[model samples]
Target: MGYRRLDKHILKAIFHRWIESQSISRIHREEGFDRKTIRSYIELFEAKGLRPGLQMPDEDLDCVLQELLPKNTRGRNKRELLAPYREELLRLVNPDASSGDPESPAERPAEVVRPKTAYLILVEKYRLEVSYETFKLYAREIGLTAQSKRAPTRLESPPGQETQIDYGTVGTLVDHHNGKARRVYAFAAKLSCSRLPFIQFTYTQNKESWMESNIAMVEFYGGVTECLLIDNLKSGVLKPDLWDPQINRGYAEFAEHYRTFIDTARVGKATDKAKIERLIPQARELFRRLKAIHPTWSLDELNRQALLWCRQEYGRAVHGTTGIAPMSLFEEQEQSLLKSLPPVRFEVPRYKPVKVHPDRFFTFEHKRYAMPENCRGQSFIARESGGILRVFDASYRLIRSYPVTEQRVCWLPGDFPKSREALMQGAYPRYLLSRARTLGPAAERLIDGI
Candidate 1:
């Protein structure tokens, strides 16, 4: 007789009856399974530490059935077919093997051959008859193309200690003013301890937008984390290195203003900021659902909806990994632990390298702002914030500041030479009049009349 394939329900039934202290003969008589089969299942359960009157979870029962069932041997047959070409396959997969000298295997750098490429090579060069799917399967079985099974380390942070931030694209939105479709991106910041997330949608991922989104996230949390783990984006990290990364000037200032540390993830390594990486997909899904409902909504409206979703839907829902609602976790544990917010909100400044004109004026946002006379014909940093354009020397010391205005040119009294100031202000005539008065009354009257 062919072996019977039993479903989970039947196995559960048999296990339940046995747990009730029913005899094997009685179970076979009642359940219609063979006596030997019932005995084997009882023995298997007993070996798994399951005893009579012990409550068996569904998961435990599933494990018992999985071990008891027979595995398919289809992979073994494929492996047998691929065994003859094992050496060739290994040569192809080796990254340092030479293509021209497969037999000798010279040490030369080359791309690791993919499974499909190996399969094609076998079919074309070696005349091996096998399907691509079977070749891939056996390649993994023989460990030629097998992925590493290294388990990832679960990183944990103290409440309010760290947050991970990244940007991900969330479909396009039509601009209200230009009536053109603009690709939108979501800026996501997730607290490492509570798994609480804050998302903002923007049409840009530039330096200003990045700083603004970070500020918004910090304010949303009502505080800041001790450290921020961010991706190596050009807007935040100007140069990415494993040991030392160069952070953007604006972003570094933003971090300083918030009293936090900025840590950049390694290049091409997504696991460095794994928390935010996981949140990105979820955020993208939320935006997808929102877009489906409000296809014609403006960017501002979409952002509002995203915020609402964060609070109501995502925040309230129990997190899969944490097994607690994010909002509840934050409120109960992480909220009080966060670093206190600064007295004033951080203003995102624009940093630019500008050349000072010969007249000691530098152009900022198409408007001319006067720098110190010493700064003329030199390159300096221009920082714009709070309606003031500050010029910084090469040493990053504040040189001077001019009020930002719509006027074509802005200059302070100290920015010009005393003589030039008088000439530009039309004070030369007054000076001549004063000199004439010092000479005689007639000279003073003549200059005044003129």
Candidate 2:
């Protein structure tokens, strides 16, 4: 069906509404005209120096609009002109030589060339009369695509051979402690063979959370894989490279404890770790479902729900590619193949070497917290774990402990001592002296001596 044409009166109404600062869509609803037609009319009026505030008679307005208004011009038909060269064009675009190995750049046939060159050939040899633009458009109309040079090969690992880890944002959640919503990230790991997966959620993707999640994942699976294929995330890989990837210190310690090697995926290649990489969308969907059930949940509560949902729903379900339930497949074959977990758990805290100031305070998380008096002018290591920030001496013995907070400066009770001279130098010294003198003449004499 064709679009309804707007008359001069309707066109003027729409343009006037637009001139009065009404949106094109709003005018379209009120004036019963398409937005395209509305834009054309407004553009026509502007082209003739006729603004909204300017006064013009109906006759003058019609004259200016009629002169500037666009006419319905139909383009010439080129179907018959190019019909004879359709098969030849297809052949030139996708030659047999190129078809043998489409991905091999070295094997690209000379006849398989650009559209412009093909158009020139048709003009010179076949005496074609169509313009290059029309030819290019028609070329796209047929099924034709540029050949690719790189042919990617699929890689698979044996059972208990490799596991891939990746972090994905699981939307926002409320931190029950602070009563504020913040973005949460999910650390996911999937076995390459059976596709069994494990996930943990955290507020931060820092070194502490990353290492904690890795430990949690291994514990959940009850075994460790020989190799870990992780993405080039800053928490895990300090510097990403095709060879000799620099792993973070904490992550390296965790790997050593688990007796596994860390192999990072190639740069710009998500498919290198496709097992866990493919689980992000699934994880997102699971998070959405959990959110609908419990719209507002703490980070821990959300993760608990995620764990139950994964086991009952995704784990027991039949796999799309392997045609077997992931849990069943994992239990029957991959379970025994995986290496045994360590006897003791790995605890890696957020560590920083800081020099204690003269005031017996150390800077942590961009904030200052009080330390022991003996730690003055000495270098100590600060560690944060389990919501408790602690300072250790050179021998790693815990010297001080304080509750973690986001405050700029925190002072413990009785940290700073008070003295008579220090108090007398205050702004309220006169009032303090008057109150002291009320006790006795001895107080007055002492205050006067000071």
Candidate 3:
């Protein structure tokens, strides 16, 4: 330490690997440096921007201010851009074409903007002095705006950006081989810029299938998108709300791991991503076209056929709006996205350790879930995703999960159901047999009396 002066490079290298146990004072004293000089050195290093602190400098008294402070992203102004319609309240006064059309202005759809604007007019009809323009300005200042044309504060996309995703049940078809009608889920993604829609058909909308569909969507385009825009699908959105959306923890982790942000469209607002929203009808058309040509055996078969359709016809065909084919745009945009996505190891939650009490076998939603006897007194995480629920040990290894698909009421082969059953039986009362005999006598007397 004495051999090197307190220069930027030397100090930085020392700072980077500084041991947590060694204090600045100890460093100064052991190195034969004055405290004042050491303080100045630290100040100079901080002035040159060395991330003086990883977090807050002092947390005890500053908690309130930290909590109250707004993040930079929150300051966006989305309301100012659409105030004219809110002020007019046209939909209130005019339920019909009596109000000017919103789109064409001359032939405004009375069903939507007309009624909305009419309502505004009717509500403020008493104030005839305030001209429509003036009133609209007033409304804008007050943070009220038309619902339809409220533009985002800043133009978000730089073109060829964002993709919106959703899952829907297209229809039910009879499974000929199984003699059963099964509903199929259509998982779809539409790139906002290109409006190029990608879809995959799957049996269920569970987490694994949900993520698998997303992976296929990415690979189909030969790239990973910077952001995945999705609707309030249960697999992705934990709580569906516009102002405060909560993405599923597993899905959020997946997004973080992939270095992508998973953005959710406002709840109940399909029009939030208009480009993708408009493709639903067209997707149905494509699905119909595929169905006419192929006989599907299963949802997996349907998905494969769908992909082939994209490569052969859908991706090649010219886009109605852009006048360019989807595949062509995808090629141009693909380069902008990540070449190699982060590894795809999703968290497989084995079990949420819900205590199976000393007496009651833990059951969830009418099904019994098994927990280890050693887990009786401890609280545990409940791992639930991918249509399966299970419990896990502290180290996160799998302990036991809900019974496998189609194996309900029976343990898997080589699983000792008897041992688990024995442990389960221990929780029951010892006097149950005597109580059962007394109940039997009471039942017979009641029957005779009747």
Q: Number of the top candidate by lDDT?
A: 1
lDDT of 2 by residue, 251-357 (tens): 98789989999999998898898778678756765564455445667668878877775676678999877788878888998889888987888878687888889
By lDDT, is 1 or 3 better? 1
The global Cα lDDT (0 to 1) of model 2 is 0.76
The full ranking of all candidates by lDDT, starting with the best, is 1, 2, 3
TM-score of each: 0.63, 0.49, 0.47
Candidate 2: count of backbone clashes, pairs at least 3 residues apart or interchain: 0
Q: After superposition, how far is residue 253 of candidate 1 from its true place, in Å?
A: 2.3
Ranking by TM-score: 1, 2, 3
Candidate 1 residues 88-162, lDDT tens each?
A: 666656544323453443534223455555666567565667887788777766666755443334588989899
lDDT of each: 0.81, 0.76, 0.57
User: Which 10-residue window in model 2 sums to the lowest lDDT?
Assistant: 418-427
Clashes of 3: 28
TM-score of 2: 0.49
Which residue ranges in model 3 land beyond 4 Å of their true spot?
Answer: 1-156, 343-355, 359-380, 384-450
Model 2 CA deviation exceeding 4 Å by range:
1-154, 353-450
Please give the range of 10 consecutive residues that has the lowest summed lDDT in model 1: 102-111
